[model samples]
Target chain A: MLKKVLIANRGEIALRINRACRELGIATVAIFSEPDRPSMWVKQADQAFCVGPGPVARSYLNIPNIISTALITGADAVHPGYGFLAENARFAEICADHGLTFIGPQPRVIAAMGDKATAKRVMKEAGVPITPGTDILENAEAAAAAAKKLGYPVLLKATAGGGGKGMREVRAPEALEAAFVTAQAEAEANFKDGRMYMEKLIERPRHIEVQILGDSFGNVVHLGERDCSVQKPSHQKLIEESPAPALSDRIRKSLHTMAVRACQAVGYVNAGTLEFLVSGNDVYFMEMNTRIQVEHPVTEMVYGIDLIKEQIRIASGESLGYAQNDLKPAGHAIECRINAENAENNFAPAAGTLTGVVFPGGPGIRVDTYVSTGTAIPPFYDSMLAKIVAFAATRDAAIARMERALRETSIEGVNTTVGVCLEILADKRFRAGSYAIDFLPQLMRAGVS
Target chain B: MRALASLEGLEGRVRALAAAFVQSGLVRLRLSRGADDAIEFRRRASSAAPRVPEAAVFSANGAPERLYDVIHADLVGIARFSRPAPAAGLALESDRELASVEALGIRTPVRSLGPGRIVSVLFDDGAPVEYGQPLFEIDRE
Candidate 1:
């Protein structure tokens, strides 16, 4: 097992990693920015070092400073929690070169999966079902030709696209050239990679994803699927549930098999997630997040597994200790992301001293947060307040428990998405588990229009 | 934590508290010293700790301007302030290295990000500074 872990993140995820490291008898070193030096996660870990000031570019995302801190603290491994340098392949390579274990996928695997177009090609080559998409197009003419082959309404997409940027929907031949040029320029501005591709845009597909884990010795397994259809149109997941409701057993099994196979084909290690867009019985590979996801708790609740610990163990050259057949989704679990944003005010970011926080506590309820009374919410980072998750024997019961938990929870002083999560729970479509990614944004539009 | 200043054993604690209070803008540190005697320190205008109201005789633009403190790294040893306390109302360039926090023959230069005037230097040259300690104060120019 790794002796020490350096958590290169802030907020609740850092706390989450610290707890796991303690349980595994691994000493933890926390790297904090200027504002984060006074944060709770700094005090929670075994030791902490100030990397830089509050700005993310100079601090959390500073690869050299992070590596220096790890070297100074004598950390054996670094666990980048979810954001920042979590998906940065160069950082992983730097860690490997500097004799530090990066507790995630291999650098090659990360680089291969980081680019959307490359990942699609890699997955397709591995026999995974992928949506018909063109490779990196050279110019607008190439994009037009690809669109003609792929049919109308093809997506002119960036190879490095994420968060809905660097993409445009071209529904006709005349719009393809302009859309291609705009997308290419946006891709350059956003990701510095002007590479463009064409993927047949799927309409109203349910955003379902499967969680998979792989060990060093070619052992791999899947932890079923999470229905992340309840999200904004911008691809921000608000609520996620495990054992994706109403999915047929046949399709679910296929998703699991395909996820494991795709991961194993690329020699993937540690924990990862394979996202797909499911329309009816067809499941098409969308992309793979080469890191532990924010919605990991829901899968953990249903599977009864510690993903962080497993990632550590796998990175330490240990087998999974459990086979594919040994793992099973026990019940149902749901997670509601509580962000510090006003749902009533177009989800504008709200920052203030959190006056009081009342977290729901009961059987099968978990609230992961780092906020308390007098905790200052810095405007320099993301507005995530907390993650409220609840588990039950049935999906309906899980939904009810989550609804009750959200109602019981209150974070005063700053506007929160708690009320919005409640509204989502009360919606007929959400309750019936028949919603898509457009659910939340459609709700907002209905309220306004 | 401010109440430690009252205890004879906690000598020079008030100066250290004042330095941190000035730099971090941590207002309202109320530490009870038992027997109805409590020490309270209040500061204002810090956007970070905005909930804490300003104390009396303080204004947005006052005659006696606030000074900035140069914080020490969280490293152990005998820290020595390497410069004389500049005269009050003395201006400094933003890139100027005001003083050095030297420990164990190694020096860490403390430079100001904002151009300011040195109001006063709190700690003397040969003071024993604890780890994660803040050092001097300068009024922004």
Candidate 2:
């Protein structure tokens, strides 16, 4: 077992990792920016250090400082919870060089999956279904040519992008050039790589993803799938649920099988997720997240597994202790991300001191948050204030439970998405489990929420 | 006993006047209350050095004449000094290298931004230090 770990991220995810480590009898050191000095996670950890100023680049993303801190604090491993340098291959390599376990996949594996186009190709070579797309286009004309061949509606995506950062949807031929230029610029600004690829857009597909865990000893198991079709207009996921309601069993099984196959093919280790776009019975691989996701709690609730613990164990060279057949997922789970944003005002980010906070609690209901009364939500980082998850024996029960939980919760001194989540829970299509990825955006456009 | 009695309630006024002296470019200030309690404040030659941030002022020579600035480490690593660790009361020149923090064999120098006298050393030689960890407390000249 690992002895000590340095949590290299802030907010609830950092606290989440700390909880897992403490449960396993491991000491944790938390790193934070200046503005996050009073964070609950910092106080909960065995030790905490201020790495830099308020800006993420100077603090949370400061690889040099983070590595030095781990070494100085005598931490045997580093757990990069979710964002910042979690998926950075070079940071992983540095950790290895300093004789500290990275608590994730090999650096080369991260490098392979970090590039979107490369990941698609890898999955395709492993016999996984992938959307037809072009490699890095040479120029605007090349993009236009690829779009024409692919079809009318095509997605121009950055080779190095995720979370819809450098993505543009082009419907017609005339709009291709401008879309390509803008996407290229965005990709350059975000990822510092201007490479562009095109894909045939799968309209209104159900965004289902399978969670998998792999040990270094070639043992990989699937934790089933999550339906993340509910998203804002910016493509940020707001709600996720397990078993992917309404998905055919055959397709679901295929996704799970393909996810394990892809992991085995790439020699992937640690916790990872394979996202797919499901239209009808057909599924196409979108990309693979090389780190633990924000919505991992949904999977954890259904599987009864602590994924962060598994990640640490795998990094420590331990066997998985259980095989594929040993896993039995139970009940249903749903998660709603409560961000500090105004849902009615185009989901604009809100920052202020939280003067009041009340989170719901009961059997099968879990609230993960780093905010409490007197917590100042800074504008420098992600706006998410809490994650409310509800688990029940069925999907409908889980939804009802989640609605009740949201109603019981109240956060003051900043605008939040609690009201919007209540509206989504009551939407008829959401209740039917037939909502598409564009459902929330269309609802907002209709001024329903 | 006479001096203590005369300085009663004058401590607050002395602090305000000293803060104004350090912030302004004025070279000197003299004030006299009656004929007996005459107070003279003089700026040192290097007092023109940029004002140190986060300096704690303490009274010396019966007036608030000394300011202690805590020099903090800018990197997380093992702190090293080229020579012996400067002892308390050792004067420091502006821009002089006080120490360096070495991480992964790369050294980042920690220098004195202005002239000052060492009030104390917070860390021992070759001690591990984190970012913003105090290393030395310097009395600004």
RMSD of each: 7.3, 5.7
Tens-place lDDT digits, model 2, residues A184-301? 9999999999998888999889899999999988999999999999999888999999979887789989999999999999988999999999998879998899999999999999
Model 1 misplaced stretches (Cα beyond 4 Å): A136-142, A160-163, A174-178, A181-195, B1-141
lDDT of 2 at A297: 97
**Residue lDDT tens for model 2, B7-118:** 6756777778777765564665667655445555554443332122334343434454454677888778899875756778888776588889998779988887788888
How far off is each candidate at the interface, as Cα RMSD in Å?
7.5, 5.3
- What would the TM-score be for candidate 2 when compared with the true structure? 0.87
What Cα-based lDDT does every candidate model obtain? 0.80, 0.88
Measured by TM-score, the strongest candidate is 2
Candidate with top lDDT is 2
Worst 10 residues of 1 chain A by lDDT: A64-73
Q: Against the true structure, whose DockQ is highest?
A: 2
Note the DockQ of each predicted structure: 0.09, 0.29
